[model samples]
Target: METLVKLFKNNIRQYGMIIALVVIMILFEMITGGLLLKPINITNLILQNSYILVLAIGMVLVIITGHIDLSVGSIAAFVGAVAAIMMVDLHWHPVVAVIASLVVGALIGAWQGFWVAYVKIPAFIVTLAGMLLFRGLTMIVLKGQSIAPFPNGFQKISSGFIPDFGSAGTNIVAVLAGILFTVIYIVNELRDRRAQKKYNFEVVSGGLFILKLVVIAAIINAFTFMLAIYAGLPNILILLLVLIIIYSFVMNKTVMGRHIYALGGNEKAADLSGVKTKKVTFWVFVNMGVLAAISGLIFAARLNAATPRAGTNFELDAIAASFIGGASATGGIGTVFGAIIGGLVMGVLNNGMSLIGLGVDWQQGIKGLVLLAAVAFDIYNKKKVTFLK
Candidate 1:
C-alpha cells in the first residue's frame, strides 16, 4: 500500500490527469446514455479537435521553452486563406498549395523567432503583435469573405478514412491495425524494461508492469474496435499518430530535445554550459509556425472553406490543453503524449457537453473552470514537492 502511494505521488501529474479523463468519460457516458462514446461521435470528436490537438503539440513545446505564442490562431487562419487563394483562385495544384502554405508558416515562425530570440523581445509581446497582424492579413487576403468547395483531394486531408484491406462487417483494417500497434507497444515496453534492468535502474514490480500493459492494450484494442465498426481509421488520425511518434522520439531520444528542456529549465545556465540557446529558441518557434500552418490546412480541408474566422481563439484552446496536460507554467516539464492526452480530455468534454445539449456559453465556462482546476492542481503539487524537499 505504501509502495502504491509512493508510485502515485511520483507520477501524480500523469496518473492524476489520466484518472480524471477516465472518470470524466465514464460520467459523461452514463449521463449522455453512452452517446459520448458512440463510434460516430468518437470519430467526430477526433475530426473536430484534430487541429487544436496539433496546435497543442506545438504549443507545449513553446511553453516548455518558457514562452507563449498568441499568434498560432492567426497563423492558421492566414495560411488557410493563402492556401485557398492559391488552390481556388490561382488554380494552383492542391499539393503545391499545401507545400507553399507550410513554407509560409515556417517564414512566419522565423519572423517571430527572430524577434524573440535575436532581438530578445518577450515572446508574449512578439506573438501578440503577430496575432493581430496575421489576423488582419487573413481578413485582407479573403477580403472578409469565405472561400469554399475545396478540391476533393485537398478535403481528404481531414475527412478521408484509411483504405479497407480486409472485410469484417465492412472493414477489418482498423482491427488489424489495432492488433499490430498493440503488439508493437507491448514489445517496446518490455524492451524498455529490459534495458532499464540492464542499466540497474529501478523498475516497477512485475505485477504492476503487467497490469499497465494489459490496461493500455485493452484501451488500444477497444478504441480500434470502435473505429473498425465505423469508418476504419481517419487519415487525420494517421497524420496525428505520425506526428506524435516523431515528436515523442525527438523529445525523448534526441539532442535538440535536451537542448530545449535545458534552455527552458535555465537559459542562463544552459548558455553558460555552451548550449545554443538562441538557435534552439528560434527553431522551436519555427516548428510551431509549421505546425500551425498544418493545422490551418487541416481545418480548411475539414470545412472545405477558408474564412477570416477560421482559426479564431485556437491559441487559447491549445494553451489550455498544454496546461491541463501537466505542463509547468515555469517550463522545462511536459511531454508530447501529455499534450495529446490533454487534447483528448478537452475533446471528450466538448463532445459530451454538446451531446447533453449544453449551450456553447456554458461549455466555455465549464472548460475554463476545468483549466483552472488543472493549473491549480499543478501548483499544489509543486508546493507539496517543495515542502517535502
Candidate 2:
C-alpha cells in the first residue's frame, strides 16, 4: 500500500490527467444521454481529431527542444494546395503527389530550420514568418479557390476502415486485435516490472500492480469493442497507433531523444557535453515540418478538398495540446502518449459540447479554461516538487 502510494505521488501529473480524462468522459456520457460514447460518435471523434493529434506528436518534440512552430498551419495549407494542384490540375498519381508533398514539406522545414538553428533567430519569429509566407503561397497556388474530388486512394487514407472478417454484426478482426493488444500490453508491463525489480527500483505491491493491469486491459478491450461494433477500426487509427509506438520508442530509448531533452533542459550544458545542439535543433524542425505536411494531407483527404482555409489555427491547437499533455513551457519534459491524451481531451471537449447543443462560443470558452487549468496544474506540481527537493 505504501509503495503504491509512493508511486502514485511520484507520477501525479501523468495519473491525474488520465483520471481527469475518464471523469470528463463519464460526465459527458451522462449529460449527452449516452451519446458521447456511442460507437459511431467515438469513431467520429477519432477521425475528426486525427490531424491535430498528428501535429501534437511533432509539437511535443519541438516543445521538448524549447521551441515552437507557428507556421505549421500555413505550411499544411500550402502543402495541401500543392498536393491538390498536382493531383487535380496536373493529373499526377496520388502516390506521386504524396511523395512530392512530403518533399516540399521537408524543404519548407529546412528553410525555417536554417533561420532558427543556423542563423540564431528564435523559433517563434521564424515560424511566424513561415506562417505568413506559406499561407500566402497557398492562396497563390490555389488561386483563392477550392479543389475537390481527390482520388479514391487518397481519400481512403483518411476515411477507410479495416475490412471486417466477421459475420453481419461485430467486427471479428477488431475484437481479436483488441485481445492481442491487451496481451502485449500486459506482457510489456510485466517485463518492465521484472527489470525494475532486478535493478532494485521501487515498484508497487503485487496486488496494486495486478489491479492496474486489469483496469488498463479492461479499458483497451472496451474501446476496441466499441470500434468492433461500429465501422471497425479506421485506417487513420492504425496510422496513429504506429506513430505512437515508433515515436514513443524513439523518445524513450534513443540517444538522440536524450540529447533533445538535454538541449531543452540546458542548451549550453548540452553543447559542452558534446551534443550536436545545432544539428538536433535543425532536424527537430524538419521533423515537425514533415508531420505538418502529413496533417495537411490527412485534413485535405477528410474534407475531400484543398482550400485556402484548410489549416487555420492548427498551430495553436498543436501547441495547446503539447502544453496540456504536460510538456514543460521551459522544455525537457513530456511524452508522446501524453500529447495524444491532451489531443483527445480537446477532441472530447469539442465533441461533447457539440452534442449538448452548445454554441461554438461556449466551446471555445470551455476549452480555454481547460488549457489554462492544465498548465496551472503543471506549474503547481513543479513548484511542489521543487519545494520538496
Candidate that scores best on lDDT: 1
What RMSD, rounded to one decimal, does every model reach?
1.0, 0.9
Candidate 1 residues lying further than 4 Å off, grouped into runs, are none
Candidate 1 C-alpha lDDT tens digits along 270-356: 999999999999999999999999999999999999999989999999999999998989999888888888988999999899989
What residue runs in model 2 are displaced by over 4 Å at the alpha carbon? Answer: none
Candidate 2, 179: how far from true, in Å? 0.8
The per-residue C-alpha lDDT of model 1 at residue 371 equals: 96
State TM-scores per candidate.
Answer: 0.98, 0.98
- 259-317 in candidate 2: lDDT tens per residue? 99999999999999999999999999999999999999999999999999989999988
